[model samples]
Target: MWSAHHRRTAILGWLVFVVLATVVGGATGTVTASDDEMGTGDSARATKILDDAGIDEPASELVMVGAKSPDGWRDAAADLSRALDRTGRVTALKEPLPSKDGKEALLRFQIKGKSDDAADQVQPVLDAVDRAKDAGAEHGVTVHQFGDASSEKHLNDLLADDLKKAEFTAVPLALGILLVAFGAVVAALLPVGLALTACVAAFGLLSLASHQLHLFETTFSVMFLMGLAVGVDYCLFYLRRERDERAAGHDAETALRIAAATSGRAVLVSGLTVMVAMAGMFLSGLLLFKGFAIATILVVCVAMLGSVTVLPALLAWLGDRIDAGRIPFLNRRSRKGVHASGSVAGSLLKPVLAKPAFFAVAATALLLALAAPALGMKTEQLGLEKQFGSDAPLSVSFREITAEFPGGPEPALVVAKADDIRSAPARDALRELTRRAGKGAELTVHARQNVAEIAVPLPGSGTGAEAKKALAELRADVRDVRAGTGSAHGPALTAYVGGDLAESEDFTDQLGEGIVPVFLFIAAVTFLLMLVSFRSVVVAVTSIALNLLSVGAAYGVMTAVFQHGWGASLIGSEKVGAIENWMPLFVLVVLFGLSMDYHVFVVSRIREARDRGLGNADAIREGITRTAGAVTGAAVIMVAVFAVFGMLSMQDMQQMGVGLGVAVLLDATVVRMVLLPSLMSLLGERNWHTPRYLRWLPQVSHDEPAPAARPASPTWQHV
Candidate 1:
């Protein structure tokens, strides 16, 4: 009777989501204004080149140069200068500067605009550079250009190109996974549609939030994609269950209520669990993780709302229509497999039950073995060039420059304050320190009345481990020098190192310290929630243990692939150094949430069967069989969506994609499919038993209380 009411509510909920998605999508175009502001790697490199060339301060005069024999290159440069003049942004460009590489050209220009958009005002100058390329080509010369304005223009274009590719791959892959999982075209489309709606709304909300808080550009796109994948996954569980119930002969309304009461409750708990897990990122004291945590929480909350409200409502409205186009080869004959009766899962579990002590010890041993590598897991910063693309021109050029100049690109800065720099003893000490630092390399010292700044050029090429080691040595030398400089300047001469390596080291250290506590907190919360939901100590403990095993194995795989350089060549990354600093926290939050989702679905069904008066063994067998197909299908879909990230050029995306895909696949198959059922079946009625005092807690039973006696089914009913 109450089932029909819930179905109507579910239909109405979906309608709301659709409306919200449409309104948000229509109001905002795909591109944002900030897209223009986020400059390219080329721009960063160009700025570094100019800075190194000692070009600073506002410029009114500029120059442009082209290849000597290339008439076409000279013409193109002239055209770009005219374009810049047309914009009324710059005063004029001087004739091309002499080309360092013979085939390339350079341009110097003057800024005329008072507007803050003066940087953007140089668009015409960029156009002229492009035009000059043709001239260089005609003369068998390549037109390579470098300048502040040209660099910015190049960066913007590159980012736009990469973004286009990412969108092209992520969307189609996500939709295709859904289609295969649901079988029916329309049914599969629903979750993707809902996920898109949530993501659009999240982007708008995040943009607005950014005005009041700090949010990185990368976070927005990554969170949106990840949130969509998870949201679709959440909806898939509920919708699949509802379909299964209807196929089993329950009316649409009854199926809706049953799904909502069971799967719906699971969705709510799972969503909250995911949110709680993500909140652990707050412990890192990093705005990046904090932003992600907040964004993820919002997306999960919206997804949960859709699962409970829209999913049920859609089921009621569609009725049997949800299963209209079943794929001939793929549709299950009977949503039952090995665990259908006291058959496969039950029989397999029976043996484990017969020797619980052995199986328990064996499983524990396996988990510990996989967990061993994690103890030695090292944390380090991924090189930006390596993250983007090892063979990219910027990366290649930077390497060349570093090799030629050594630590010229990356210098360790040592800043110290002293009571007085005029003292003969202090001057001597400083000179000696600088001489020692420069012994094996080039070191430059600058001193003021009360301060000294030392620039130490490290040995070997820059942008890799050797450069980092040199910086470390320089810091140690500075420390030794400070210690030896006695009481005259001792207290006031405190020194601190500040540079690329210092900042990166600080970030990595913070990330490592925060991961353990955050993981423990997430585990503790998951344990309490499971205990409260199922009222069984063993079940709660077993659930956490299984989740950890899956996570551990996933990390081990990452260690092998990313850290050990296994298959790295296939992926395009040259050096496999260390995992991303924050990947562990991100992986933990995501894995815990996903693992809990499956756990709740499987256990909830078992509890439903048990409530119908079936013994623990029979209920588990039935529960697992009924739910396994749907769980497996859903996991496959998720795995597919996550795997798409592996196609991206970005290293961070690859790590995230591989880590999540492996974890989900393992949890769904090995841990959930085999181990969970085996463990539960062995426990029997004890699996659902609660402690004496805890019996007072409210319990929602899925089955109606049975009459004292009933006729047994001919095939398998037992007295």
Candidate 2:
């Protein structure tokens, strides 16, 4: 109220806050998640051992020298080694090893730097490799490079490009949609502008928070994606309600108050619901999820605050000027609620209201059918081959490297700590371990003092089932070796088998264990919040069920398209055969949270109608129709924004984008528009039922007092 009456103060204060937050965040900078923090299980323990021993694992790279004939590989390998040596970034160059066919030789080397900085520092080395490639091409010898540094560099570039594209594409796309939704340039710009500023402020604040939480590199991208979505959504809801009130012939002040009392209340409830859902990630037991939760929650809070405070103030200051620069036909349609009066929602609602049971049963059955595929859903971490697509240069290089020398790109490491790794007993244990690895596998050991690292080249493509089997066998072998060497009750040497595959597997297991608890936490809290807010057990239970259906349907779609290869070609996405391990849990939390925005807004509107003199069916119809345009606009904007991510090169991101986009689309139309109203109609008065025990819960209402009787306006001009 104060913000609306003192518009100038509110506006200037918001600008100052944004600027200061940005400056402070820039000063604090961000801390990336450390390797130990990112690791899990034995992999994490292995990393801790290595770090404690002051052992630094430099970034390793490999160059495959392939020739038409055997003798050519040695010369090409020699030249590439010299070229790499001249770059000064190369260290510990290993002897060129021959492939099984003897026609390919692999030149292995490490980049001279901290492994984390290797991606940024490897450009000079890559330039040298590129030159080597050009020279080798003249000799009819193919030289391809694949390794941690090169692949990470390429992946980082792809991520940056994708985010930039999304930033440019999503913003204008949102603006254009809002323009159509509002039918006026100024009104359309308001939401977009507020959303953008909120994202900026949240970005700065999150950066500062990163110093304490250790955020992932993708945290900012996720924050921006979510911020723009919810930011615009909240503002759209508030502005539309205020405009509707004015169009109903209330003076500007009354219109603003009604909007604040109604949509403003919905925004608050919805934002809290979203934050609660996002907090479910804290139960995931992974630093990554914790960081993601903080990022999302921060942006939502900032956006929600902006919606309730500055947005109302801006509307008050603009008054009728908010509707200036109106487009002709668009303005007329918006004024007449053309989106609802004869629209699809209206058309569906008629039959749905008339035959509520039939429509309700049918919608429920269809959604359940769609959700069936999720029963077989499987998740795995995407390797370079799948993440960057098979045709990408880095993927091609990795495939070539793995083909020439299996598991050469990423070998499993067995870290053993003993009294003295150089002692005869330790040496025997290590030798026995290698012998048990069998004939086709090659093993090497690097030992210093009491710490030793044994590298085993796993069979088959890295990250494939074969490699996983190899890792498991190696781990078992180490345990046996430790037991054989033990003279006391415990094993003489402490050992951990760790590598990229181990890390991925361990992380996947962690998520698997966390899923049930996290889901239960989110569902329980959301149900409680809804029940208390709506003062109805039926509304709470049904809302949870409907959201679960939406999430399940989205999961089923992702499984079919990404894993089962159903309709994969239609969208230009590949059948990666498994969803990204983190995607399911991440999507569950995000979708459950985001879908509530529309769910709460629509339900609140419906409850408002019911609070008035309207009957259940009438209230359902009125609520769905009246809020159709805004909900559709919000859903479309979210879907469009997420769809931009679906076009990204990374399969995991594609899954996330598709999963979220599909869920929002389903929620807004099928679930929110059809199933919800039909179900409510069938339930009738039971929709608002609360048990006697729960009746003591405080009454929370988004309903505003009936508008006072006033002189009717000649036309809808006050808006």
Cα lDDT, all candidates: 0.64, 0.87
Full-model lDDT, candidate 1: 0.64
Give Cα distance to truth, residue 276, candidate 1, Å. Answer: 0.6
Native-to-model Cα distance after best TM-score fit, residue 137 in candidate 1, in Å:
9.9
Candidate 2, 75-174: lDDT as tens digits:
8788788888988999999999998889999888999989989999999989987888888889899988889899889888988998899899999999
Q: Pick the TM-score winner.
A: 2
Worst 10 residues of 2 by lDDT: 710-719
* Cα distance off (Å), candidate 2, residue 503: 0.7
**Cα RMSD (angstroms) for every candidate in the order listed:** 8.4, 3.1
Instruction: Please list all clashing residue pairs in model 2, or write none if there are none.
Output: none
The TM-score between candidate 2 and the true structure equals: 0.95
